[model samples]
Target: MSETFAGKSALIIGAGQNIGRRIAQEWAARGARVAVADISREGAEETAQILRDAGTEAVGLHCNVLEDASVAATIDAAEKALGPLDIHMNNAGILSGGNPQDIPMAEWQRMFDVNLFGMVRANNVIMPRMLERGSGHIVNTGSFAGLYPFAASRVHYAASKAAVVSMSQNLALYLKQFGIRVSCLCPGPVMTSSPDAMKHFSENYVMRAPGSHLSVMTQQQTAKVLSDGMEAGRILIPTHDEAWETLVEVAADPDAFVEKKHREFLAGDPGRPGITQDVIDSIKA
Candidate 1:
């Protein structure tokens, strides 16, 4: 929101991978003492090394978000290593790509564990502490897919994120009095793993031009956007500015947007939702 970072201690779960790693770097560059946490200690250490190379104070810790003890231990380790936690990024998540109904029960539960309950788990720890201290921020990673359950391969993934959105919204209201802010980053089609599958799925689930796309933004672009958006204390941080237009359009007249989008779906265009596979892939590439 104001982009304050100097002398702040921030813990980012899932800090080993692309988006999480980039966020760590960005925060480190801003002089925040970072806790690069992941399910694997080695991955976390690697990210910490990257931060250390840049001369930032950081520690790598292992925490399985699905387990309460593991999550608690990681939080304690982070606070011990990084000093008091002023910002907590609940970034741990899994992307299960495929039809929802056909997904294995194990996979579906895992999706909820990381994408929804994991977020809640982290927040349950950090937020109470924040409220007690009377000031803090919890940034949750959501997705544009959450906004509309596009008939993508990752239907469960979308549902999980939708839960995150709803949770963050309520938490925002609940934590406002404590001076603790809660925000969710609902970005569209980040260029991550499984590109072809993402593209194939986006064909029907998202809106996009044959070549143009709105869901995919550069990592750096999104990083910058996320940084600014978080600092601004926004509840929903969307990358493409025009995304708000669509959101507003949909909110004002859901029936119309649904009608138009459904028509596109029936016509087999599959590119009228929010993004295209090509756009998503190119952005990732």
Candidate 2:
């Protein structure tokens, strides 16, 4: 393992499993002590155990992003165990799907609480410390849905992620003078667990992009890309090349992109027969 990050420490929220677990492992492999935090204490401990087994310094912590005090306590405990944090990653989020009309306002708030405000809560605590030190890296996990409004099924998730991207970019612009780096990771389809996991995720969590196919990457592959991107000081990192390419297309001709996206939405989902063309058209109007 490279000692590039040796003597450094990373505090990662949502590190129980999936992409979060992989990210914790990635940093640990690169020679950083890691604090693995998650809503599930067992999950966090499991991840920490894995790192320890691999000869890495690690600790498992329970952190509920929904609670302000839980987040504060976790960060405090992490620093006490591993010294000051060199990297703080917010990877806590809930995956949910529903038509825009069907999703209740309460549901929208819940989604925002986990997917958006969770990062906000952490930053509220960590940013001040980083600013005081005059150095730190903040990584926010977003989704490609944030960059493109094509995930018709996950309107709330997309919206929350869009907010994350916006916040991350703005923070990067402001924090540059302070020597603090912010990265927004917008990944496309990723097999965070088993190969079959993607299938389960597709059916339950998000709708596939219309007229575009995505290659699902493994957790390790996604983590490696994030590690490399962070090393290069990239503000925006998309795991899939296709996601980046689509963003370029959208930026180049937004009108065409919007029209194309709506056309796809209007076609309706065959699986979700409740989503009719009329419903989509009405939403557009």
Candidate 3:
């Protein structure tokens, strides 16, 4: 309806559901041709069909961020269907919870492979073409946990996302001269399709902080915030007030703030359980 992105083309990895799917829909509504890529072919097709039904040019492609070949193939397919990409959203990620010291090496590697390395894989394939075009926007989805060290159980996830934040910042600085913009969307808790994700977050992360009041947004609401930020050319898209405040506090006094939060977390959950198969399985869904 807005047509702000008329004639633009976007590739959204992880567009099968949740925030990624919403972003794809929003971009198509704004008149951009979209490629919805996901590990689930059915999900990707469903998203693309929804866009097509709305009179938008859209395609569905299978992509597993863990595989470099898959990433390259998906990019090729997207470009073939939607023309050259003007926007790239690396939104695929997995969640894992446990004490860093206790989580398995394999699980840690898996988390990094999907959450952090997956971003690298997509950027590696798409950034050069974007550079050659002399203009593009790359939005990497990060987390509030990445900004601060508050979520003790989500160590692997937070670490991977923190790397993403750092990578996006450096990318913005490196590519600004080339007419490319990079942004890190660091949002607080959002309503996800995972039935128990909200409950887990409420019990583990949100309520752990005594006076910290963080609002949870629906997927559509979060998508709108990110879309607005990307359109406005913002470098760091902080979607929640609490996350912003935490970022500010950390920036002002990194050591003191981090130490205080670490103490608070330990004080609140002294008996936090170790990484169990059920805990891992819960997040897998």
The worst-scoring run of ten residues by lDDT in candidate 3 lies at 201-210
lDDT of 1 by residue, 1-285 (tens): 135677899999998866888889888887788998998789899999989999999999998998998998899999998778999999888774654446677877887988899878888788778888999988998887777535355777778988998898898998898898887887775565534433222323333321124555556566777888877778889766766777787788888886876676667775533545664664444
Candidate 3 per-residue lDDT, tens place, 166-230, comes to: 99999999999999999899877665664345213223332332124554566676777888887
Global lDDT of model 2: 0.82
Q: Which stretches of candidate 2 lie over 4 Å from their true place?
A: 1-4, 193-206, 265-285
**Clashing residue pairs for model 1:** 1-230, 1-231, 1-232, 98-153, 207-273, 207-274, 207-275
The residue-by-residue lDDT of candidate 2 on 202-227, one tens digit each, is 33444545234555566777888998
Query: Which candidate model has the greater lDDT, 1 or 3?
Result: 3
lDDT of 3 at 209: 22
lDDT of 1 at 209: 28
How good is model 1 by TM-score?
0.86
In Å, residue 263's CA in model 2 sits off its true spot by 3.5
lDDT against the true structure, each candidate: 0.77, 0.82, 0.80
RMSD of each: 4.0, 8.0, 6.0
Q: Judged by lDDT, which candidate is best?
A: 2
